[model samples]
Target: MRRNDCFFVSTNIFSTGFCSLRKIVRWMLVASMLTSMPVLAGKTLDGIKARGVISCGVSTGLAGFSAMDSKGEWHGLDVDICKALAAATLGDARKVKWVPLGSQQRFPALQSGEIDVLSHNTTWTLSRDASFGIHFTSIVYHDGQGFMVAKKTGISAVHQLSHADICVQSGTTSEKTLNDYFRAQKMKFRPVVFENFEASLKAFFSGRCQAYTTDASSLAAILQRETRNPGDYLVLAEVISKEPMSPAVRRGDDEWFAIVKWVVNALIVAEEEQLTQANLDTQKEHGNAVVQGLLGNADDIGKLLGLDRAWAYRAIQAVGNYGDIFERNLGSGSPLKLSRGANRLWTHGGLIYAPPIR
Candidate 1:
């Protein structure tokens, strides 16, 4: 029988009949072999697969969130998310291109298709969601705006520096937040702004400003790595605004958004099940139903997302677990040493939680 005749007789061809016999046969063959091959209706995932690398946007250098080593290796919480997505989709953690983006450039890069995912330290606000043609997938870090000052300045509280000169990075929520904060408090201050984060840190170090104001996590990072004297600076305890940092993707791509969102959930689920890269091989046979679903041992959770049964398994093995990613990048294992205060798992009295994979 002719190839077109074969597809027609079998009723396997899509309702929208194809013109070419060769195309019809190839589609049937692919369908038979890979039952769960993802439908790439959103061109973003297909583009990443075609290019053999997922372009991930990240901060130029934000210590535990996103930074580069002397050997040009990317490391941080944001970097791990990028790698995890690569591992889940392409089965290779290293199949990722890191695009270091500034605060203002990150969204534009994602919108322009320059990056597949923006995992930088970006706050999710109502205005950003409504204005930008972007969708925030999940909040990876719970943060807040705060102030940092040199210890010898005798500044202990937000109101202490009423007439202080503050260094802030331009084109960031921090810049505007800084302005609104002092104005609301009925205080006066000089606003010293720089285009880039490094320049703001440089100015802060040189005494161009008496204080540096930004997210508390960023303040901790500066104290850890950017300062000549780590002990000389103190991060104030007052959190001025809520900053929920999340990974964002261009809106209108439901498939790509699900892939990124589930990759993050896979990490958290792996951590909850105590499934580490070292123990994943054995844990696939774990008696717990949720663990079985997550490890692709039973029900094959990836089928729902049109991925291979082992997609989540590969991601967990590549990046260990969510806790592993956190500790390695931002906690005691790294320079930042940030305590997992609100970022801890729900079982441990923190907010990190994931839905069931079944």
Candidate 2:
């Protein structure tokens, strides 16, 4: 029979009551085979491999999220994400070109292919996720908007700042949230907006504005690192809005998107498996089934992500797990000294959770 005749006959067999059990089983087997096929690597992965580096966009300087130290080395929670991606894709965590971008430049740089992925401390919102030509991989940090004021101001609460001048960075969600909050409270305030993150902080510290508003974690960092005396500033208890910070990549590449998404998931899974950089090699040899799968010992999970079997193993080896990243960058081990309040694993009564590696 012709190919078209065969296709029509096979499709109509079920409706015509001519289908047999053997044919049904054959179709099911074919479906299973098709579903088990490996995913093809996309152009983004191909370009990264050709160039031997992954271009990553990060915040200009935000302590505990993305900042440069005295040695000019970038170290933060977001920087670690970029390193993990580099390790998974290029087999070397150092094979990354870091592009520091301001608030307004981050999205345009990612959209224009100047960067393969954006690991900046960006909040995931409905409008940005749907409207931008980018896909948010996952929420790596859960944050909220807050206010900071000098202790001498004698302002203790959000309600105390009625008709006050608030310092905020322009082209950010914080600016919008500040307006929304005050308008809802039936109050008025003068906005001291600056395009640069540093300028905003400078203006606030110089007493140009009554309060400085941003993510609570960022406020803590600023208070610790920027202020000469940290005890003089206060982070208010009022959290105005939910800010789920996530890394994003340009759209139109499902394979690249899946690779980025699972690389993050692998970090979380490593944390759940109690896998750390120090003991990763030992666990690879004699760990449990889940640990073995994560370390590329039992299953070829990396193949499904268009990578080698040791993709996740290399990522964990380079940056450790999610918990390790958090502790060293934002938690007690770092200068920020921020608590792992909501960024802890779900089993510990927080929101951090990942799917099974298998």
Model 2, backbone clash pairs (residues 3+ apart or across chains), number = 0
Which lDDT tens digits does candidate 2 get at residues 218-249? 99998888899988889999899999999998
Q: Per-residue lDDT tens digits of candidate 1, residues 1-358?
A: 6988988876755544554676889999997654323222487788788999999999988888889999999999999999999999999999999999987889888876778999999999999988898889888888999999888898999999898999988888988888898899999999998886778888888888889998998888878777777888889999899899899998777989999999999999888989998999888885488888887888877977767899999999898899999999989898889999989999999989988778
Off by over 4 Å in 2: 1-41
Looking at model 1, residue 249 earns an lDDT score of 92
Score every model by TM-score.
0.86, 0.87
lDDT of 1 at 157: 92
Q: The CA-based lDDT of model 2 is what?
A: 0.91
Model 1: residues >4 Å from true position, as ranges? 1-41
What does each candidate score in C-alpha RMSD?
A: 12.2, 13.8
Q: What overall lDDT goes with each candidate model?
A: 0.87, 0.91
lDDT of 1 at 211: 92
